[model samples]
Target chain A: MYKYNDFDEAFVRERVAQFRGQVERRIDGSLTEDEFKPLRLMNGLYLQLHAYMLRVAVPYGTLNSKQMDMLAHLAETYDKGYGHFTTRQNIQYNWPELRDVPDMLSDLADVEMHAIQTSGNTIRNVTADHFAGAAADEVADPRPVAELLRQWSTDHPEFQFLPRKFKLAVTGAAADRAVIKAHDIGIRILERDGVRGYEILVGGGLGRTPMIGKVLHDFLPEADLLPFIEATVSVWNRLGRRDNKYKARIKITVHEHGIEEIRRLVDERFAEIRPTFNGVDQEVLREIEAQFAAPEFRTDGVDDYDIAYADNPLFRSWADTNLSEHRADGYAIVSISIKKHGATPGDATADQMRVMADLARKYGHDELRISHEQNVILPHVHKSDLPALYLALRAADLATANIGLASDIIACPGMDYCALATARSIPVAQEIATRFDELKIEHDIGALKIKISGCINACGHHHVGHIGILGLDRAGVENYQITLGGDHTETAAVGERAGPGFSADDIVPAIERLVLGYMDLRDSADETFIETYRRLGAVPFKDILYPKEAANAA
Target chain B: MARAFTPKVITSNLLLSGDAVWFTANDTWSGDIAEAEFLTDEAHAELRLLEANAQTGVMVGAYLADAKLGDAGPVPTHFREDFRTRGPSNYAHGKQVETNV
Candidate 1:
């Protein structure tokens, strides 16, 4: 929703031109692959397994109808008629040719979007809660501060080359939909004595070494947000190890030097840099806050919605699963499911993108959000308009009402597209979702988060899933290791591994057994899989996952 | 004793299209894995890989991948290399679409 000013537009256009030149040089033999690889990565272009992949930033997962249309156009014109929305709230075009990327970027710049900082060692796209403005429990819209941070970090000279990639997330609600605990810096907007402030956490990350952030500042004043964040990153930038790529992330740095020492260092750095910020950041934040103002709501009865919910089982099931509580009266947040059973998680065809864009324009107050769970959000749909919206989604095959269920999985493009993946993730995710749907008990299972990663990079946030499936190559065979009871919420904790791995063929049945076993183990229907796991611990679940071993022991 | 040397083929992704390509016996890049020059000796594989890496303007990320001689030609020995030749399992968009494999 933050419109690009003249300066922002100029900067983006200039970067596109610069990249265009770099691409030309690379093709013409002036620059070698080694020289051009980093430049291409900085522009969010990667030489993936099958083709060039372009990652376009959807800042804080916010999009207008026009921008959505632009993404559809890019998919139709430059890519293979579909785009994969990633866990970082960015969209990646998987098959763009090397020569067509500059034009693709130029097209993106026209829509106030670019792929800048989507990759590389710079601060990546700063994600926030998908329900930032519409969530009923939010204390404030976190996007204003998120936008301010975007402005501050984009092309910042001091942070151009950190030890490794840095990620930041913000959430205004206590529910923690943004998974803030697993970021390098996680900011929670808080209010005390009717004055707004922040609670800052640092050194959280999910990779080979997963960590939940430690509280660096229990409460930081609203005015000191920028300076304090800069101080924290600056301290890490100086002290973070460069000897090994695996040991370079801030989590390892924090682990090596305890949180207290890191806190002390951050405090010392904050003292040095706190005076440098002269309150201009606050002014910019206020301007951004105005742009995020709530849309005009219609104070009308929802008689049609009520009738549809009562009469049609299909509509009722969809409405029950897909809708979330809105902050405004008579409005509901609609989460459009991109993970239809047997489809690639997070992929939306060009036609589907256009349909979502049209829906946003016609009924969703021109606002759309890409959730980190690989779903799309119509943040401000009126209750009166729900029936029509649902009908449109149903026509597009987007009405798979399995949000927060076992069928609603978050998966990375593992060996399927990624050059670094050790095994395939998408097929595993597909099989699991399809199997669950066939079982017809996803709704019964209730509020399960199944996240799969191709490798240890944790791009799918598998470490935080209620049921995490990690794919790996074991002696050249595809193997999946399961982790149980991970929570991505405020009480975030890494899942515990359930024992030995399963072959690709056995994985789906293994998951089915685990879920079915939970059904028997749960005290009541109200007890979710995660709640039961927490109550009984991983022993029972491990038995369920490794049934052969358990049977042999018995 | 050292493990027996596995036969290998030099592979890279084409610069323009970013599709998987293998060094053929004819000293040119081919998208089809069957057309690759399968090297049985370790010294030959290393030399071929180095030669393939030098074609920077044509491709990127050249490396040696395990292969075994098939009835037609060289075939991938690992699943990753097989996926590279055939494309992703979920879709028919990559080499599958082009080569009709």
Candidate 2:
């Protein structure tokens, strides 16, 4: 995890002090809501339907045990007893008070974390693969580049007032766990001739207008990364639409002007700005790289893990589903499911947070990661400790053997908390998870991503799910529209809409029908929902989604 | 012709707590929607909204929401406003928790 240096610490403290004064001024009527709204949003505070929401950035989704404990403390002391881990790999406290937010920020700064740039038109928190350092297929750890971007983008005067909110994601692996294709700038680290470089994709986004990013650069040398990125953002900042918020994103800019024109403009800007960069970014990156060095691994035997897998069916089930192959031998990446059956997805209670913190401290080299799929990951867990870890997780109700299964749904805090939401997403996610668990066929369904967004903002990344449920207000009632055949991996594609929407009451059963229908439709169990949908096309899935239409046709 | 104006209530979130509050008949903010001054006339509703917006120190994002004169008092007609009146369906933490008290 990246620790705050003297400069970083001072900067954060000064920001907290500034926000505290702003809050006080707002209270004293010196600053009206109009004046204070932007200030508060800059500090990651928003007045939602019921309460103030504070979105705290977890840089590249990396955290230490101490930071995790502080998040738990924030949840327990200030607002509700749990925090919602968002799809951006940040945590949102939904019920923060206006008066207590500065103090909350101060508390966050204590652990080298702050909510800065988590909102607003500024470059949001730079996210990366949660399995960056520990994934088996990683070419390099992407966190160093992510950290470099964070430092470069934070309070960057030139890009702060961009046309719209910008997002950037980086991944070191070939498989797109970071969902790089759906970001404003998606960077994939690759090696050619033993020299590390980046494949830059520009203009991809997933909101109302979903677009797969186009290849801006085939390969840019590692040294030119920051300059290249700055040039790209600068070009977009100049040309991106300012008249309409809907069309303000770089994706729209690229779409309207065409990627060829955008690329030409970016090249022109890159030529202009390339000379000003004096290798300081490289120095900072080198420093940041040291901090993200992989932990010493234990090369011990996995006899205990084998014994537990052979003896205990529950352990085996959890190991099979929740564990990912680690880069090191006898090591496994443990994804702790916050989405327990019948529980709100992405919400970890303070107790659960503390338990995860303790587990990370004791067994995971004090490193923890918040995955975009709304799960906490101990990315460096040894296989020998799997039995004990599984037992502890089971005791804490975190051992839900459903990592990529139907129950592990990615849901946004929809109408339940968001002021922008049209319908409730949490309830839908909970119902689906509970129903799927009840059916005991989640494992059979296999590697299905069910993402739900409250509205068209795609905060839930609904467009990328194998089965996407978008909640909308149709005729003043909650209606859910289903989309099929979406994939958020290397083969990223926006899921196509199936047909008409389902009532809120009918949605869970509708999903159950779709998944059960998928089982029947698949040639074999090994073929996942996405593969089945792809092989057979949308006709069969469309029939499954609209059974009434199928029945009427028959 | 424009659509006929529905019954409405002036509502905003309290600046201090960020909880939803309705402009009551007594010219004070109330957490309960029942105490809200329901305006059947569009002109009166706009005036009430202006009054609510003027209380900058007390609240933020004041706007008129669709409501109806229910058996008890003014009730939210839209699901969004209803959610504001009660709370989120997922947890009993917001207005629902306070209302129980």
Candidate 3:
């Protein structure tokens, strides 16, 4: 966990004070609703369906026990004893009185957290691999860079009011847990020929228009990162479309201008800003890096791991799914499944928060992370403590043992809460997860991600799910559109839309039919939903979903 | 369809020494409750807002009331609107941390 410096402390305090005054002025007739809306938005507040929703930034989804406790307190005291952990890894309090928000901000500041840029059109929270430091195969920790970006972007005068909200993500591992490819700027920490650097991927985003990022620079030297990023943002800032909100994101800019042109501009800007670095940025990065230095590992032998795996079927099953290859030899990166069967994905109660906090403090090395897939990670759990940790998690109902499986769906809080949502997403996700679990088909399916978005904002990353469900509001009726073969990985691609949108009543059944179609079409049991879908294409699945002869034939 | 006009907290900003008490209600604070103007036309909305502001006084939460102070005059933490407006205070329970002071 990175502790806040004096700068962070003062910044949060000042922001809280500033927002407090703004609230007062609004009350005093000095500010109109329009005037106050943006001000509140800048602080990560939104006026949702029934009440005001306050989204607190989790800062790349890293939190310590103390911060988790504070969140628990807020949920219990201010909210309805539960917090919705979003796909961006931020925690949202669905019901907070507008008046109580300032206090909420103040409480967050006390924990070295604030909700600035969790909303509004500016750069939102910088996300990264939840298993950053502890990943078995990572080149280096990505958080230091994520943190650096965090500090640089926080209240950056130039980018405060961009054309639309910008997003950035980073990953240390070759495996893409952070969904880096779906962000405006994705940085992968890399080392080539003895020197460390970053692989910069730019102009990738998901919304109404989804795109896979192009590699802007193969390997940018570590020192030139800030300048490189600054250049990219500046180029997009000046040239990005402002006429239409939908076309304003860097994705559209990259698309319209082409990757080579964007790269050339970014390089030009980087060169211009290179001389001004003054080594201070590097020093800051070095300082942050020291904070992320790998934890001490005991050299004790753990020869029993294989034997335990062979003996225990449940542990073997859990290891098969929940564990990731660690950068270390004896340890494994653990992604604890928060999405239990039939439950809303990415939601954890106050008690669950506490248990996770305790687990992070105890079995894990006080290192915890929230994945973009809406799961928690005990990144560097020792192979020896796995059984005990598993037991504890089972007791707490946090142990689902399904990480990338079908039941572990990524679902957004849809029409149930979001004012912008056209139809319900959560129930559809729930029913699908439940259906698969009841059929006991989850394990056989293997490594399928089903993501649901309430709307085209694509908050759930529905655009990149193996199975994507998009909810739409059709004349006061709820409808769902399905897309297939989208993946959120190294080979990221937005799913192709299935034929016609289904009614709310028809969606879950349609999904079941689609899955059955995939099962039948799969080459072998090893073929995942995505692999099968890619090989078969959407035609067969479309036929299954729209079974009527004319519709199927089309 | 009948839409009831309740004093909606349109905008909330914490001001002064970090007091979170005030929020705009019908373009003016009314201690979290203001008699709203029913709008059939633009003029009625404007008049109702003006009258409400006049009746409720300045955008002050309950703690700002002179009578509520009793022996202790004006404690920032003591105001509910202060809590609502400013958010939580330095004192844990919205109690005056130093009552003697």
Candidate 4:
């Protein structure tokens, strides 16, 4: 984890003090609600449906055990003994009072973390693959570049308050766990002839309109990243729509004005901006790179791991489901499943937070990464420690053996807490997960992602789910519309909408029918739902979704 | 053709607490929508919204939501308003927590 320098520390402390004064002013009636709303939003505070919600950024989704403890402390002290981790890999306190926000911000600053740019029209959190450093396959850790982007974008005078919020994501692995293709700007670290560089994709997002990014530059040298990205954003900032809020995102800009024209303008801007950089960012990158150097690994722990696997079936199941291959010989990347059966997808209680922190300190490398899929990743855990870690997680009820399976659903906080939501997504997700668990066919179903969003905003990344559910408020009733065949990988595509929407009561049953239908449609047990969908089109699945309509048509 | 007037209530989140609040007949905010002043007339609803918005210290995001008088008082006509009144469905939190059921 990157420690804050003096400059970083001062910047956060000053912002906290500024927000404290702003809160006082709003309370005293010196600032009107209209005036205060944007000010609060800039500081990651929102007046949600229930109480004020504060979104704290986990920069590139990497934080230390000490920072994790501070989050637990804040949740216990100010919130309802729990915190909701969002799809953006950020943690949200759903019930912080306005007066207590300043204190919470102060607490966050103490851990070298702050809520800066977690919301508002500025660039939100810069996210990276949770397995950035530890993945078995990678060009380099994307966090150093992600951290550089964070420092550059934080309080950038020129880019602040653009037409709309901008999102950037990076991935080191070719597997694309970060969902980089669905971001405004997606950077994939690539190496050519032993020299490292980036594959930059621009104008990809999922909201009212979902898009997979176009290759802005297939191979941009590592040195040109800052200037190149700056130019791209600058072009969008100058030309993007301010007339309609929906049409304001860079994706739409790239859509309306073809990528070719945008490319020309970016090139023009890059020429002007590149000279001004003069390798200062490269120097900064070198320092950041040094910080991310792999921690010391010991290759002597083969016997203990082998013995534990042989002895325990319960731990074996969890290990098989949640652990990933690390580059280091004796180490494995552990994914702590927060999506317990029938529980809210990404929420962790204060006690659970403390337990995860303790486990990270005990078995993990004192580092934690939040995955975009709403799970916590211990990027470096020795294979020998798997059994004890599995037991601790099982005791906490965090050991659900359903990663990349049907039961591991990604759902947004729908109408329940969000002012923007049209219908309830959480309950629907809960019901679906519980149903699949009851069936016990989750492992057989295999590698299916069910993402649910309350509305078209796609906060839950519903557009990219193998089975996507979008909850809409239709004529004062909760109606869920399902989409099929969306893929969120190196080769990403938006899911197609299935026929008519199902009622909230009918959604889980409809999903059950669809998944069961896919079981028969699949070519073999080895073929995943997505592979089956690709091999044979969505007609078979559509038949399952709208069986009555199909019968009527027949 | 003109749209018909529907029943409405002035609603917003409280400034300090950030909890959902409805405007009452006494010009005060109430946490419970049951105590809200339901307006049948469009002009009156606009006037109440303006009144609520002007009290900057008291409210945030003040606006009128569609409502109808029911056994519980001003019940929400739209699902969004109904959801806001009840809070999130995940856990018993917010007004759902307050109900203590």
Q: Estimated TM-score per prediction?
A: 0.99, 0.99, 0.84, 0.98
Better of 3 and 4 by DockQ: 4
Top lDDT prediction, candidate number = 1
- Give fnat, all candidates: 0.92, 0.98, 0.00, 0.98
lDDT of 1 by residue, A443-533 (tens): 9899999999999999989999999999999999999999998999998999999888889999999999999999999999999988999
Question: Tens digit of lDDT per residue, candidate 2, span A226-256?
Answer: 9999999999898888999999999999999
Which ranges of candidate 2 are over 4 A from the true structure? B99-101
Candidate 4 lDDT for residue A299:
76
Q: Model 4: which residue pairs collide?
A: A416-B88
Q: For candidate 4, write residues A1-554 as lDDT tens digits.
A: 67789999999999999999999998998887778888999999987788889999999999788989999999999999998888999999999999999999999998999999998999999999999899999878999999999999999998897999999999987999889999999999998899888999999999999999999999999899999999999999999899999999999999999999999999999999899998989999899889988888877766778888888887778888888999999999999888988999999999989889999898888989888889999999998888788889888888888888987889998888887888889999899999999999998988899999999999999999999999998988999999998988887999999989999889999999999999998988999999999998989899988898889989
For each candidate, C-alpha RMSD in Å? 1.1, 1.0, 9.1, 1.3
Whole-structure CA lDDT of model 1: 0.94
lDDT per residue for candidate 1 within B28-64, as digits (tens), equals 8998989999899998888888888888999999999
DockQ winner: 2
The ten-residue window of minimal lDDT in model 4 chain A covers A297-306
* TM-score of chain B as predicted in candidate 1: 0.92
Candidate 1 Cα outliers beyond 4 Å, as residue runs: none
Q: Each predicted complex: what DockQ?
A: 0.90, 0.93, 0.03, 0.85
